[model samples]
Target: MALMITDECINCDVCEPECPNNAISQGAEIYEIDPNKCTECVGHYDEPQCQQVCPVDCIPLNPDRVESKDQLMDKFLKLTAQKS
Candidate 1:
């Protein structure tokens, strides 16, 4: 599943640079995660880097955008292909 930043986010600016997929962006209020680009760090890290670095613990899986591990890997592969 893609992760999302909650309103509890303090805008700490730590998670943005940590995203391998560059899925996190500053929104009107807080940082937002683009589901299309987020693979929960599957292709890059064993764990979600953003979640590890978020001090507020506000990043959580987007339940509404639930996806299996294989789906996440597919997205990751597609993203890497676009870069090449």
Candidate 2:
């Protein structure tokens, strides 16, 4: 599943750089996660880096954007292919 930042986010800016997929960004109110770019760190790390670094525990899986580990891996591969 892709992770999302909620209103509880403190805007401390830690999570943005922690995301290996470059999925997190500062929104008008709080940081937002781009689901299309997010892989929940499947191909980059054992865990989601944004969730790991968020101080207020505001990052959580997006229930509406549910995806299997394999799906996340596919997304990661596709993203990398685009960059290459």
Model 1 global lDDT (CA atoms, 0 to 1) = 0.97
In angstroms, how far off is 60's CA in candidate 1?
Answer: 0.5
lDDT of 2 by residue, 1-84 (tens): 888888999999998888888898889999999999999999899989888887899998999999999999999999999999
Candidate with maximal lDDT: 1
lDDT of 2 at 52: 82
* Model 2 TM-score, 2 decimals: 0.97
Residue 11, model 2: Cα distance from true site in angstroms: 0.1
**Residue 51 of candidate 2: its Cα lDDT?**
81
**For each candidate, what is the lDDT?**
0.97, 0.92
Lowest lDDT 10-mer window, candidate 2? Answer: 47-56
Error of 1 at 58 (Å): 0.3
lDDT of 1 by residue, 1-84 (tens): 899999999999999999999999999999999999999999999999999999999999999999999999999999999999
How many residue pairs collide in each prediction? 0, 0
